[model samples]
Target: LTRYDRMMARRRPKKGQAASKGYREAKKWRAKTYAKIARQRQDTGRKWAKKAVTDHDAIAVEDFRPKFLARSSMARKAADAAIGATKKALVEMGRKHGRDIRLVHPAHTTMDCASCGARTKHALPLSERTYTCTACKVVSPRDKNSARVMLVRAGLNPAGVEGVRPPGALLPEAA
Candidate 1:
């Protein structure tokens, strides 16, 4: 919401007759503010990502493209999240070590019943944090459930039994 307000206020293109030296100055100020916010978010993401990759031998996270989210109504908020920055930082950090960074598929990660393995349509509003499945009665944090689905995609069962690792489970092996 703030990002949208900020972006709108800052990036409005000048119209004919409304354009003036003063108006140009105001636009520049707003643009600068928006850019500053973006940089701050990216900086924070980079710091956290660096820590995760440095500390953990293996990191499992949802594999998502920020561009797809950018096309949504929540574009501004998604941009503010700096997902690309974090992933970039993690990849570089992981490369420095002999570690792996996993980005599991996001499909049905949240809606699929982790207990019964039944897929169902889950249309939980973004405001809702709790996920209550109607079919299998699996209840858990929305993000955690998604993570569990991702783990399953990587062939790791909910009970923690290891299996064949999924593609991209680790950083690409050196040729």
Candidate 2:
């Protein structure tokens, strides 16, 4: 991937009357490269999904929309991670295994703290991988904490709601 990035960065516009032909050729080559990389990513995802479905009875993941994130400056790396492809593969594998696959909404999963339900203006930086909850002092991995929040949003377990954990586990006044 680094090599590909360098190649693309070094690419120059073609000069003279044959420039259009050169441009077309370059476009075709880049398309081919993209297709190949996508195929490789899909294949790896299928393998991982197959293993996960075989090992676990139910799989839960966030239903993320990559198109919107792609428009953001800091999300291109995420867009390239093949999360959608992995989810699709997991769903297919779940069907084969007669298991359940769930995707929770992505809204508020990151911003809402899993512990203490404290929703503050602490938007995490993209480079930060750990989640540090200032309200409850419950620190955990960013992805795992986000996943827990997603589960709560999906109503998996009584997450401090009506008849749930004592008040303050959720419903954090947040954006």
Candidate 3:
């Protein structure tokens, strides 16, 4: 799309001149592609949100500010992911199904130790995929630890237990 935009810019008419047929066609194509991608993202977001609502009685998610995140170098990727749209869909699905959808503050959820409730002094960069608690010497996967923290904040597990699920707990057969 960028390449096409550049190509059309050169072919487009100068001041006071009408746009060329090729430029018009390129503009049309760009609009069509943009609409197509928007529709696709909306469809995907709704589908995933519906499935999550169907599978779980309650959903806990971080109340993320995507616009703030998009101001960084990850702007394009964050915009493409459409996190806000997904959240909206999830909330709508939750209301329809009478399921709980809790959006908790995201601060410290990732850096804090889920087991000991201790916050790491130093920031954990994205390159670090595992979280090691300095106080308790407990190690946990980064994403899982954050999820557990969110669940705890939502009061889903008041005991603050970690890794207590039975084997194959999420498997369909276990249901």
Candidate 4:
């Protein structure tokens, strides 16, 4: 898309001027390219959503809203990730399949410790990939910790089918 966008920009016609043949072609190509990308994204999102709803009896969704990201530096990356579309697909699939889908609020999912439920005084920078809880001293990958937080917020045990917790075990969502 970026390549085609640059091509279109270079070929763009001046305001109130007749568009050249090259400019029209480039414009059409850019539109088609973007449309194709969107179609592909939608296809994949639906497929994955179907599989997820089929496999999981209950789901805890982060309920993340990526609209604000449009004005940020991460806009392109977030658009490529299709966070909103995938979420919508998952929810629709779950509803169609009669599965339980929980939408956990996104606030503080990154700063709050999944194990101890302690929030950091300052928000973690995007470059930082590790979450170290000051209160409980538990170190985990930032994404992993956030995922657990979602489960806990949705009242999930954070354990899978093979859940076998020993006495006094530290559960991921115990907090």
Q: How high is each candidate's TM-score?
A: 0.61, 0.63, 0.76, 0.76
Model 1 lDDT per residue over 26-80, tens place: 6666678778877887788778877676655666667756655545666655663
| lDDT winner, 2 or 4 | 4
User: Whose lDDT is higher: candidate 1's or candidate 2's?
Assistant: 2
Per-residue lDDT of candidate 2, residues 1-175 (tens digit) = 4444555445645555343554555666778887897898899889999877766565667786667454565357546468888888888889988986788877667877877677758678878888888788888888867767776766665243323333333444641
Clashing pairs in 2: none
Taken over the whole model, the C-alpha lDDT of each candidate is: 0.66, 0.70, 0.81, 0.84
- Tell me the tens digit of each residue's lDDT in model 4 across 8-39: 78888899989989888888888998788778
Judge candidate 1 at residue 63 and give its lDDT.
72
Model 3 lDDT, full chain set = 0.81
Error of model 3, residue 36, in angstroms: 1.0
* Candidate 3 runs further than 4 Å off: 12-16, 68-75, 78-80, 158-175
- Tens digits of per-residue lDDT, candidate 3, 86-174, equal 88889888999999999988789889887888999988999999999999999989998888888888878835345345443475565
How high is the lDDT of residue 90 in model 2? 86
The collision pairs in model 3 are none
Model 4 pairs in collision: none
Candidate 2, lDDT over the whole model = 0.70
